[model samples]
Target: MSVSPRRLRAGALALATLAIISTTACTAGGGGGNANGGAATTLTVNTSFVLKTLDPGRVYEATGLTAVHALYDTLVTFEGSDVGTPVPALAESYEASADATTFTFKLRSGVTFSDGSPLTADDVVFSLNRLKNIKGSPAVTVSELSVSKTDDSTVVVTSATPNPNVPVVLAMPSTGVINAKVAQENGAKDGEDAAQGDTAQQYLDTNSIGSGPYVLKSYDPSAQVVLEANPNYWGDKPQFDRVVLRNMDVQTQKLTMQRAEAAEISLDISGKLLDGLPESLQTSGVQDTVYFLFLNADPAVSAVTSNAKFNQALRAAIDYQGIAALYGEGAAPGAGLVAPAFPGTLPEGEASTRDVAKAKALLAEAGLDNPTVTFNYPAITYKGVDLGTVATKVQGDAAEAGITLELNPQPLTTFLDEMRGGKSPLGFTPQSLNYPVADSLINNMAPGQATALRSGWTVQRADPAVVAAGEQVTETLDLAARATAMQEWQRLMNQSSPYIVLASNSSTVVATADLTGADYSAAGWQVDVAAVGRR
Candidate 1:
């Protein structure tokens, strides 16, 4: 999920509480093209989140992924907001081996990078290899796939196991292709080895070296990112000549949109805030992002949280409906790790419901009565919701079940650092889907995966059922079979209760009355910047 500025100085949580009471307000109208008149050549977007990096390899956050989608092209892409199927992008066509262990892509002819350099299979090989070799947060997605150039126009990716979700995985922003010549000439040092350090980290953080619709004109980590249309782009010209991504606080974002200083505001806004906006500004349908509470199960790090019964007690104690109400309209209690918008997601069940008596009994069985646990969350709001408020609600609910939660709110960067390093005993965080496949959820929760690590579970202690179910989802190619596998996997995960899913809130993008075609991707975190335009 995207990280926003720190909470308001005072009374922010109180405002959140009041906002939940007014969630029944009417939904905002849809955006149209230049309803106010006059053509717009440049688009200004104000957001609460700041950019982490411009480099495709290092960018894994929601805000960074939005910029990467506009500035880079992958071998394949999800077509027309549908992430369930992959379509040709840089690659004209692709084929997978009968055993599903090897996949080949045929590059499109006459394609060139933003720098005017011709696109080739060598570039694809270099980009994919560099992605895995870099060993960044996104590297885990393709760590098992080996890339090799078959010729100038053909590239082959081979896997040690029979993995069938290569196409969907390739469509991810992390798999974006970069100009090999430009990168190597600038600061990219190591060839394909993981031992060498990445020298281009700093340079790529501010530069663009890809074949996408936009080129990075200027970038300021704490301010804004300016992107100009790529004249050498092989696809249709972007409707806007330039795009500006401004970093601002939630209040500032609201003020800018109200003053018409920004054409669009792409941040998570509460329903109350949306009601306060001028009717001229329209809101798109909710996007797919889920908010949850993760409990660390590593006894070495947190003895209290590691107790299975304690974890289950905490999960059962949460008021899922009340928390969902805090998000207002378009938000619902989460059914599982995967959002309900996507295919193969499990059906809504009673697993996440509140049961104070059961929770107390479970806590007693674990020899914990009125025990305290440190609950950590970012001091800042995530997307648009106030996580601090959510954490407070969790504390209140857990208290009803004879548990005391000590709230610890930290700055965004510091909170993420501690959470990633497994220093937090329990964390309140949100996760946006990376892709539409059920395997995406599996990749995050299975043994040695990203989410599992965040919850302080190492490969040695990961539940074998999760590992086996994950393998089943990846090894089976049939969609129906995968759905069944995912259901079973979700069931086992719920029983373990490493994380308690509170709600899946809709992602909203507010735009000026004139701006139109600001379509959302299937994952709902990214917008089609190239498709957006003004009258």
Candidate 2:
């Protein structure tokens, strides 16, 4: 167990190789050092997906989100928990009116955008209402808000009814506060008329302007983005002076780490790469983020196809823990859609674990005997984390459950497009796109809420009763009432539209022996850069 840091670091290097080759990460964070141990630290990180655009509104995918979080800060920093339990970010604190339908935020003053412009209450008003108007943007995000500014430093945001997660949604990186002036200068598209076919400024796609710890130094699209710390950061300044993110192939990233071009290997590695690591790397020092299949069952694809029983059967067929084990030692089986770190969210009763018998029984009830389904996974190429193998195992499990499944692995672009677009009948992906607020996760896939793209899988939306219940849930600011509504919402989802419950990915940090400050706390859905440092 006491392998020298040398032996363990080598193993970590090998694991990094496998992760990079086999799979990709959605939101990249962690790993850095301040060379002089001053307020400036520059560290190189790895990610398979490149930032498509720096604008948060335009590019909403996970990879592009990595850069967005650093470039812009939201009103509420998704703090405390990732599954939508929010603490204050820009708004110092929030208080709900007696009815919970009304909320008032006391803004943090002296906060300026990267350009030395003031971030006033007015910008908050513009950012929000604009989010609701964007035709093709994520629809469910803005459903509950009714925002108005009371003063330059005071903003009162209300829900259409009893809404508690308003602050949580505001904190998500997707809701990063844009400098109203800068947004206009960059030709930032207003969400109000995106579907009207208005061609917004194409240049804003590559440029960024907001309030964050780092400002964009340079970007080469498919190559790399260089970031320099902002001297005027509202809070503690970044430790690094400048950070360089390179977009090398999986293998190249591996070689560079051994050569020390990369002080750390941040991408998930392949199983084969595990062979490259010495035994010490396999120890507890390394961690694993969970992987699961995200299934999209849009009604647009087929009517009988999105059957509740069919969905339930698919959920029961595959073994999540078994699939996780295929990766290595760090994986854990999950029982619900919401990961455990989120409070009051995923309790045992909320989701069902593996039951082959239940799977068989459910499929038979759904009359989906010998059914063939297609599974879409993000195209990954690392050696060890073979989704293909998981797919193959799922196929075998389905066969035993009297169901047939076809497997498809694709690149991130295709996977996200088809999944968010809601074009695919069946696909497997993660719901890791959560904020600190519970509603952030709930609303995304909720009834009457917006679908990621338009997959048309709002099975619950088709039912009016469900819609009313969801609205009533947001209408209450009372903690008890909100919890009740969430329970009912999840209860209905579990009873009717259950996607396969997958594993909650765990965080594993690999660093040089000299590196420290490995504290991992819930900081929104994002990995907290501020929490990272040397021991």
Candidate 3:
């Protein structure tokens, strides 16, 4: 039986019902006190996440990336809530050329993989080159950067063009360094070595061989992933000897947290639900994620959405404040395509806000009074808030401006298939930043990118001014100059109204009172397992 969107969001009761009737039992009973009457040191995190893979290069989704962060070390990383700054991780130090096209990294000595293999420049080069050769969604993280071994402890990365944000991009978990020898022995295919196709995917999918604080004990895609402390890890050992990441419904997660069967819950639970949790459970810092509605500007998709006046009307009609409220605390009405947490984002005064009268005037100018358009959205909650609620609010507010919206909500998988395939005329989607950089947002959302294609805004249909402004933002190397250039790009984008900013959200994670040291970096999943310990 297919589940309805309402039932999915109202997780507790419905999930309890489903669990009682299902033949398979949920893995909801762990992290309890030890049999000898001592407190258990194992840390169990309950989440509504389905991990895709353990392979760093192949893992692109948020949940999988979080696990990768715990298991692998990247060249650069962010500490705590600072998303703009990049700190050295595997690289002891790094320097960029004046042109910003070339970066040279000096690896830390004495670091070894879980298997005790000493980390070398060759491993860094191989891991990076392999990621690009694999050509996965995360390959873009290093796609433009060429890797070379300068010495046993040095690696040089040269970009095709000047990119000052190379270090920030490398901070992504997908750029995690892997054990080249282990990977190759376990069937990893390298450049010019895929004669029989990459056979290492399956092996790496379940096993992790990194130089981080944890080693993969086991991974079951649908159920749970077990991780144990790596004894040979060069960094500080994690407080917990064992960590279990269980995949379960949000309702089960809540129950586990209540019963003290889990130490933490990382699922996107609503603020309302979180408020009801006992004072012993508290929310950690927020992650960088933004939700928005994209209007197909291609006339071939829908003439109504393609009309500039109509797009403007829709933008003005949206209740940005109301939607932001629904997202609860730590969410603000989106200012620009990039979140305010990142550099090069527009300041508050430049962002557009709701204006009902202006919306009606635009509708009248377009000769589209009471015109109807379908707004497609995923039925599930994103980042702990129901996107369906956001769409409904848009529908009601648009009607007040003499516009009619037909809501079409579908399962996330189906919704994405249609939206990403450019079949949906209008859609609501969340853009999660792979790295805390303005370029990541612009490259994905603006003209001549994948999102532009998905929204049916082909290059020919893209606004020349917006395209030109985007180029200026891209080529500018100085951070201050880029921010200034982005202002122009954002102005052009706001005028075009291809996509209306809804809200910029920070991902929330609730944990028991005693659990501390959760790192909610803007990268979405940089939780520091090494620091999370009992008070």
Candidate 4:
């Protein structure tokens, strides 16, 4: 038996099941957690998001990807609101057979890599094939798609199936193209170094060769990363001469934003910071971060947390209001796995409701609500929890549901180790599913102690349904069938909070009056800087 992982709930919902809850009133700002009103001429964005790697192929970490976007561009991309639809970036025009399996792309003629080599069909094929051959970040993104370069200027991508979202996947920076010459000459891996070539870690420490709007200038560990505008950029020149990413303490970064050292401030604010900031300044709560306790779901260590009822009890017991208030600065209550625009997009009280009754019922069903559990939190320097506001609120809420929740905060690396090492009983980490593909997020939704990429969490927890649907969508070269299949996929994830889906944070951004285009989503994914302007 093939296990028929694809058979979700039997009947599929007709194309429309539930409209994706628009977190914003359809406005990027509405869904964003920042008070990004300034139109500064030069944005001095001071973020702790130091560049760990410049290689788009393997830079899956949030902080790393933030820097990659500045120095690289992808083939196909997305516009506002849509997840899979393709929007032009590197590719000027493209043609796909009516069946949607084979796509032919025509690259702009004059585009050149940062290394000065002209971009062409060969480069496109080289990059895609490299990604497919590699075992790192972008590999999963490009895994199922088949590729071929028809000629010097045209590349054809053939999918196992007809997929409308192939363009979206292409748009992803992980699909960012690299210079074949640079990769060859240095005996280095550009991006596909993860599984095969040289590894992103080896390549990015010293080299960056892409056909992006910006070119790499310098990198100094976690201290700083600098990029000068690529003069040979295929697109219009950026408004700024350079973009600098700096590393600083969360509190200092906040202060820097207040004092205008940085053009922007992003928040995944910790309770400790919220309490320490000047009262007047503290109230300037920007919608910046999401706070949710993730269950590592280890059968041996976290049997209770892994229980569906336990997950329900914990979520239901949460006093979303109190925690939000504890974080202060006018933090709003969070709901579901996603955060919605306050007031209009998400009706007031939409996610803030406290259902004590529902919680109690869940705890009783779990038969172990009173079970003792310790949650490992990332450290303070990185805005990791101090275990007071968030954990306390959770502790109190869980208490109401007859469960005892304990907090144990550790350094980021240590906490990461316990969770990834497959030893953590319970870990408090926040996660987001940015692409709208529920299956892609299964790594974070492990029911059996799923390991993260860096940490040892195993990928075995990936539901067969998720895997099948994911695979089918990639291989299916037909539209109606793919759509029909995806509808079922989305619904299954919605019903299964196997990961105990918590709040999807809003990325709050505050910038000096100089830089523009520093929008962070409520979900913390960096904003696309194609149209960004800097003073």
Candidate 5:
């Protein structure tokens, strides 16, 4: 349900104790009043693996993105589920070079950070440069680009290559502009030494300085985060006076929401939890993430998995529809490498149906007799669905095709280490992208990329046709042409690749029926906290 961007690997957190829940119920409940005796509304959101960091340049995890998104505003942003289009946020307007190599932005006038400092082009330049130099997980988002200030209200970004998605990249939470003066005073640095010289993470963990709707009031990585409305916010005032995000496990989340405990909204909820849900709660979702199975192609790791025919057999044996059914509504059989929410995906019916006969035939053609393989996966629940449960289903399906799978479930951290080190011959995990762009997904899954390399599929060993198609997609500048290239790439990948598309689960959010505007988006910030309001 999350990755390295929470993209390639999802992290895990221990379940909160019942005492913590009781404490949260007392402190973070909704519909309360302030000391002045006036109505003060608070929205409580339940989620796990949050509060990793508040620094925008370093925040890449799903929940971390959610926090940074509220505290900071990016130059461009996706509006209300329209992730395909990027609109100005901190920037009033922007222009891109015809070749798509350069972009110039005009900062919105009269915007102020939480500290009441005027927004300046220097802040935008400092933020982007610091993001690149921090060498954090999110730094890769701007690795190919350079940013500079041209004037007090103008900033320029130049790319090393034609990048039609630069605007979309700017919308990423990692690019959120910060108050440079305050950040510098707190030890934030720019240039190549920022990875070591930047020391503002600790300070930023509890303090926020941005031109967004909410400001950080308190942060406790082990418990919850508190936010208050920013009085100096330049945009529409938020309806809620405060918001609280609590860290709770999936079962706890389900229990809390179903019982109307302390939270009004729940994140990372599985579709299975929606069954017989009370009418007092409403749900909204989008198919924003995919769980996939990949077999390492490195012969040194596993000769059996390196076999092309065996890979084909494994793909054929998987019951894609059955996996989708596990998540219930809002889930679907994954059609290609890309998640279903984005464009360039294969049509729904195009996914291969389970064919036991074909799988057995392929295995026989590979000259393997009842080949036994180790299927390794994380032993944790992701977005309410247990990975072990999914792995068990896959194991059973493989058995039907005359294959034996020795399921090895490891802790999330250990599993991630082994997977990233290419030690797992066969692995099952979910990859969630930082942004909702087809090229970002393609680049991550393409040959010689992060996902492929993690699966031991390097350019030297990858199919020339598939590699060429991926290159074409990245090199194309025109949107229509890029889409065509992406399609061809997926076609070739499906024919022969280490990864198999399994199921795309919906990014589900359940909110109290009294709440309105709890919309869903495929972006890093799954739900726009600033937009939620009581009916």
Candidate 6:
């Protein structure tokens, strides 16, 4: 779910279902409040969303993950922010082979889907297979895996390689379990050709049939997604009878909260905008998204940026602390490319410290002076942080070190095209993990991987030791051993990699003070709407 902001789509039509109107509209944000200060019947949340589909197997963006989470339950899930371990959800217990290639899960008995149908191993098998054969962006998480049903209450999964983190991978929202019978009747396919043959997406856009806390009431791509409490929900009933996730901008979100007009929680407000907020509003910071800049290693793009000496100079010149400040409180200098919450992330003290003298000296050593490089970034406020402001700060800091940065901000689509095609000599962007695992972040920087390919880094050009360390980290399943291997990889990357980590920003959620379950998590759905309730 690369933290890139999704632009608004045009001409999206809404479903004809009537909306559940909030009661007592004059109360603090959560709609339909009791006249005498009791529980609210409806919860309204506002955020700038990039929602494309409601289908669990196909959703890959942040907002889509949040929505799918409420509608469907995964085989396993993390508690609070404890991503280090996965707790059972649909599966009551699970076991992995010593070789880490095979896993068996025992489904929880008596669990029923929203439609009151009994859940079985068949649903688990169908969900994982549909996730894989559909070949959507999320399919990468389940790559090299096969799922099968052993009995009504038992299921087994196998990986092509020794993947110790299969449970953690299963915790991803994309792996949410679906009602097999209902989905199949609605045109779902799990065969290898499902990528083209699967026709369940349109059906899922309006109908949600899963054993989760909520069911889809209606969905509008451009406007809002509405949910109602599932009568057959296996767990404790959700606090609100109705939850409305509206696609409203941050400005409207702030105004709504201030006026006590509608929305109770806001997921897209910038940290800088928190000042002067009313006393009724409270905020929780989830610092997980890591922002970075990368220089293309391909000489065809720019011989100067490809030079190792120039890369070192630029890394030394940038003021990491100053950049971290731009994200306001809760932000910090990135410890490594991995988010700080991940177990294997580098220690805080290992973060970069700027030294302009070293930068100038390195530039001289490279036999270059007064060199100018064009810096490219998407010209939009992604997740409330304006890249242009960050770019201007970087440009100013670079100027002090005798380097010139030519800022070229373009439309997000064009910028992404150039960056992905390796046409951008230098680029700035933020990336969020698709799943909560160290491998999800570190693996991208490996030779020939997604981020590496974007930066023109190939195995032949990379340090052999760095590549070996990365592989070791991925192959090692032991927690402490993997942490050691991750540290070595980060140390090597800090030395020569084209990527320079800027800062990790906190994802802030502004809500009314009385909201009880405004909890935050780095894994799936920054904040769980199902958990939100009045104090």
The deviation in Å at residue 183 for candidate 2 is 4.5
> What is the C-alpha local distance difference test score of each model?
0.73, 0.56, 0.74, 0.54, 0.79, 0.79
What's each prediction's TM-score? 0.79, 0.70, 0.86, 0.70, 0.89, 0.90
lDDT digits (tens) for residues 1-535 of candidate 6: 1111111111000000112322221111112223223554888888776677779999876677888889899888876556778899999999999888999999999999987889898888999999999999889889889999889999999999888889988988889888899899989999999999999997887788788888887777667887777877888777887788888877888777776633378877755666556766666666667888889899888888898899999999989999998887567886677777676778879989999999999999999878899999888775567889999999998899888999999988788889889899999988766677776555677777887988898887788887888888888877668877888888888888888989977666677766766655778576788878776
Off by over 4 Å in 1: 1-40, 61-63, 115-117, 187-190, 193-207, 261-263, 268-273, 285-287, 295-311, 341-343, 349-351, 360-376, 406-427, 433-444, 447-468, 522-525
- Please give, for residues 116-179, the per-residue lDDT of candidate 2 as tens digits: 7888988887666656555434335666676888899988888776655566667667677777
Worst 10 residues of 1 by lDDT: 9-18
Off by over 4 Å in 6: 1-40, 261-263
Report how far off residue 481 is in candidate 6 (Å): 2.8
Poorest 10 consecutive residues by lDDT, candidate 5: 3-12
Leading candidate by TM-score: 6
Residue 200, candidate 6: Cα error in Å is 1.5
Off by over 4 Å in 4: 1-43, 62-64, 78-85, 95-101, 115-117, 160-164, 188-207, 261-314, 327-334, 338-352, 361-388, 408-427, 433-438, 442-498, 521-530
Q: Each candidate: how many clashes?
A: 3, 46, 1, 33, 7, 1
Question: Which 10 consecutive positions of candidate 6 have the poorest summed lDDT?
Answer: 8-17
Please give the lDDT score at residue 421 for candidate 1: 86
Error of 5 at 409 (Å): 2.5
Local lDDT at 233 for model 3: 78
List the candidate 2 regions with Cα displacement exceeding 4 Å.
Answer: 1-41, 79-85, 115-117, 126-140, 143-146, 182-208, 254-320, 327-330, 348-384, 401-430, 434-498, 506-526
**Tens-digit lDDT track for model 3 on 1-535?**
1212112111000000011111222222112123223343687777666466668877776567778888889998887666777898999899999999999999999999887889898888888888888877788777788999878999999999899999888888888888898889888875845434567777776677788887777766667777777777787777787778777777666666666634565555544455455655656545256677888987888899999899889888888878878877567787777776666677767656899999999988998869998889889865557778888998999999998889999987788789878988888887766667766557777777888888877668778888888888888888778878987888788888488888776555666666666545567574566567776
Instruction: Predict model 6's lDDT versus the native.
Output: 0.79
Candidate 5 TM-score to native:
0.89
- The sequence of per-residue lDDT tens digits that candidate 1 reaches over residues 333-428 is 766777665666667664378989999999989998788888888887655567888899999999999999999998877888888888889888
